[model samples]
Target chain A: MTEKIVIGLDGTDTGERALAFAKDLASKIDACELLAVYVIEWSPFTFQTAEENERRHNRREEEINLAMSRIVDPAVEGLKAAGFKATGLVRHGDVAETLNKLTVENGGTQIIVGRASSDGFAKRIFGSSTQNLVMHADVPVTVVA
Target chain B: MKNFVKFGLTAAAVTVMSSPLAAQETPGIDERVNEAFAAVTGPFVSLIFAPFPGTEFPWIVMWLVVAATVFTIYFGFVQFRFFKHAIHLVKGDYADPNDAGEVSHFQALTTALSGTVGLGNIAGVAVAVGIGGPGATFWMILAGLLGMASKFTECTLGVKYRNEYPDGTVSGGPMYYISKGFKELGIPGGGFLAILFSIFCILGALGGGNMFQANQAHAQISGIVGDYPGWITGIIFAVVVFAVIVGGIKSIANVTEKVVPFMGILYVGAALVILIVNYDMIGWAFSQIFVGAFTGLGVAGGFVGALIQGFKRAAFSNEAGVGSAAIAHSAVKTKEPITEGFVSLLEPLIDTVVICTMTALVIVISQQLIVDPATGNYLLNEAGTAISTVDGNTGVSLTSAAFGASISWFPYVLAVAVVLFAFSTMISWSYYGLKAWTYLFGEGKTSELTFKIIFCVFIVIGAAASLGPVIDFSDAAIFAMAVVNIFCLYFLMRVVKKELSSYATRLDAGEIKRFSH
Candidate 1:
């Protein structure tokens, strides 16, 4: 059976490091496939005015397109060029939840994510997405420093 | 620095000119401004509020009631049958993960709710019950219930005929549905009605949405901080509103979206506490409502009077059939236009039926509205208005007094909530007005900015002026919107029925996904 690995992309150098680590691990494993996923952080509970709500769909699509072109698509292309089977997924939702859901759907054996810089007080109190994934992800999570 | 000095000097001159001491010497600036506005707006106000021939009822209220009733019947009591499904839609049980839009059904409802759930619930209900007696609450609840079908019809058509621009931003409201739905049905005069509706929408946004809100927010603040020049409060409000609109400050909008709902909950929570504490009076309050609704409790016009106030306030509060909520609901991410309509019906139930009723009940039970024991009627003053225990306070003050009587500290919290409510309403209506303005003048930054500046200016004018002509003009403009909107709803409702039937068929066939357990 093929081993599927899910890599979280944040469009940063840290994400590149996580991808590199996953790629190195994939080379060691036989019949491995890599999935590059970019999750746009979104919360449904926030209030918006009529105009804001009207524009939100367009904005979400723009963000997804931008993420696909600038991060996920290039990474997937690089992986494919380097002789690895790779794909891309972009979605709007909680970062950890989207990542985990995608992994479960794809039957991913492991999830890899970069350790995003934790700077804000909210992050300290609520814990980072990496922490959340580590705690709740069904598959093994590899966190790159 | 030079511009700041110039602005400061100009403000100081206006402040001294309009000061109370200067007013004591002669007719004040406030009086002059009020008189000027009253003169210009008087005839229009009279025309709008004109009693139906040989009756005390205003034709506009009749227009709204007839439309709501027709919609309710035409849809087979949709508000009652689909009420549970509406809740399911709002909860995202049927939300397809692949839906195109970012706004969930819940967000659309709250956004629209914040707009409609302002002074209408707090002060408008007070005015309704104040004059109409407790009986008005009964009609208000009934109107709110029927108004759900009105919202459902307009919102479904709103989504069906919405303008999806090349930029991906969407615009939809009565204007869109009236014009597009009519055209699709091969009807004439749709364009004329659309233009007329836009004009009324702009006026309604400026008057009822901007001015009335500012006026009430100023009144509440003055009640708390002791009387002062309203222009001071007006200028402050104008500056903040200008920042939110012209400065494109998302943070302010974000903060308002977060805080106003919290305040709404806090206001309702306090009302619930008072209701629980006065549990013995609940039955008595209901009796008063029922009795007043039918008998008028010695109010000037009696039964008809209570019915009028109840319908008027309910129409104004929930804004069902008014088409503004349609604009907000049009943005929801649903392939089925009827799904948004289902979600939109919950608005009136929350606004008038629940919140406005709570305000009315609190006022009734607090003993603020004094009643004569012998006559079993509310005691009337020289003007034939109900006399309240708190110095015969009316509007927001009466509401404040009612809550204050129960919690003592509630008036202060209420004052804060009133200001926030006013601010949020102003923001929402600014967009509504801007949409109308753009429809007339075409979409561009200059047209948008002109409306924004005008809206902000009206805020100051609203806060500074007395209730007299400002409120009259506000009511007139808002009802005028209903007149044009409901007229269109009558014609376009068939399209909505079609959408509803299709949605129901698909839903029954299990074509619609249910994501929740």
Candidate 2:
């Protein structure tokens, strides 16, 4: 069975670094498939009006399409061009929790994600998802700085 | 829609014109306004609180208690059966990664909690025990327990019938469920009921939710800073609440979703400390509660009185069958509507069962009531019950006196808590009021602005108005909401039952996937 390497991407320069690291690791391993996942943290706990709630389902579909076409597909195409068997997934949830759930469901052997670019007060208070993935992910997680 | 707007404007004009005259005629604006409000609200107050024929109890309390009991049995006590699952759902254990919502179960729960867990828990509990004695605490807990089932039923329907928009937003509550659920069942009166419910909800939002909050906050401030004109407090509250709510529901929800949890912990933690300090009195407190509940031991109106106060306060505190929480819980992200229902059971549990009970315990153990130790009876006043430690006090002041007994400076901390609690409740109710407003008038910028403007005006009105008619009218409006909402619940709860059983079957068979340990 081929080993699975899951790379978490956030459509940032750091995400490219994570992909590059995954590519390098895939080459070292004899047979491995690459799965790139990008998570959009959409909170369901928001308060919305009837008009807003009416449009929520359509808006969510648009977001997923936008993420897939504009973000995930382009990145996956890049990985494929770079001589790797790569697939991309777009999900809406907490970054770390979504990534871990995806990896476990997909039977990934290891995971790689980029460190958040901005280490400001907001990130300090909210905490970096990369750190969260490291602590909570079922699989071994590699955080690329 | 135009007519409604016109009526609102006329009412506003009357208030605005009267304010100047009242202020000019009487230097004491607060007293004058209170008198005017009392004059206006007196009849409505009597009508709402009128006792049932051949009974001393208000019919509305029986209405709520009976509805809660029926729901508990109809659902087979899902509150207990799914208690663990509800906790797991709140933790997002079964959440699908692709679910479309703006917040998690915990956030939704906290936001709903913020709305219900307000002045009712603090001042309302004190009033219950003050009148009904420690026995009221026992009945309050019982009512809270039964209320959990009502919360479970309405919230499930809230999510099930909620309208999910294309813009990643959601709107739900009794308005949607009554209309949609009734339509699904081929019922004819769904539209009328929805309209009626929306009207009551708007009134409730304005009266009980917004105005009452402003009124209470002003009262607390007056306790600390000498009596000032209420409009001053009202204007200040209006400005602050407007600032928060005008930012939209997300801004309102974000604040509540954060503040409510922290406040719950802080408030409950303080109560726990008091209970622990009075460790020796813990058993005695429970005995007093149990005895008071049955025999009305030294309490006014005896067992019936204790039972009435308990049920009334619990209904007021948790708002289980009121359908307001359905609006908040409807935004939860889950394909399984029953999961939101399960999570929502925690709302009444936290609000009435745990928090209200804690408040009652602290008051009971504080020995603040004028009880005669020699006879284990209350020192009765001319009205029959023991007088409050604080003269002429009914609500928060009584609770403050209770806490001030052990924690000398607790009243100061309580003042801050009251402001925050009032603020949180105001914002939450604004969202609720806004939803009902938009529902009736049709959703638009103009209509939305018009409703919000009226709501802000009520904040000022609530603060400046005397406690008599304003509070009574709002309380009546809040209970009036139940008349319509609980009626709908009778028809729609079977839908919730179906959803719950299906969810349960899937879970028991291990068909539900767990994403995390």
Task: Please list the C-alpha lDDT of all candidates, in the order they appear.
Answer: 0.87, 0.82
- Please tell me the TM-score of chain A for candidate 2: 0.94
List residue ranges in candidate 2 displaced over 4 A.
Answer: A1-4, A23-33, A41-71, A93-97, A107-109, A115-145, B1-26, B100-103, B247-253, B373-375, B381-386, B390-392, B514-517
Question: Candidate 1 chain A, which ten residues in sequence have the lowest lDDT sum?
Answer: A42-51
For every candidate, the chain B TM-score is 0.94, 0.92
Q: Tens-digit lDDT track for model 2 on B275-327?
A: 98999999999999999999888777889989988998898889989999999
Per-residue lDDT of B270 in model 1: 95
Q: How high is each candidate's TM-score?
A: 0.94, 0.88
lDDT of 1 by residue, B1-517 (tens): 8667546544543443344334444546566767777898899899988999998889888899999999999999999999999999887788766662389999988999989989999999998888888999999999999999999998898888899989888999889988988898899999999999999899999998998998899899999999876766877887777767776667888898889999999999999999999999999999999988889988868889999999998988998988888888888877788988999999999999999999999999998888889977788878775554458688999999999999999999999999999999989999889888898899887788678877877777788788767778888888888888998888888888888788788888998779865
On the 0 to 100 scale, the lDDT of residue B516 in model 1 is 69
| Clashes per candidate, residues 3 or more apart or on different chains | 1, 27
Chain A, model 1: TM:
0.96
DockQ-based class of model 2? acceptable
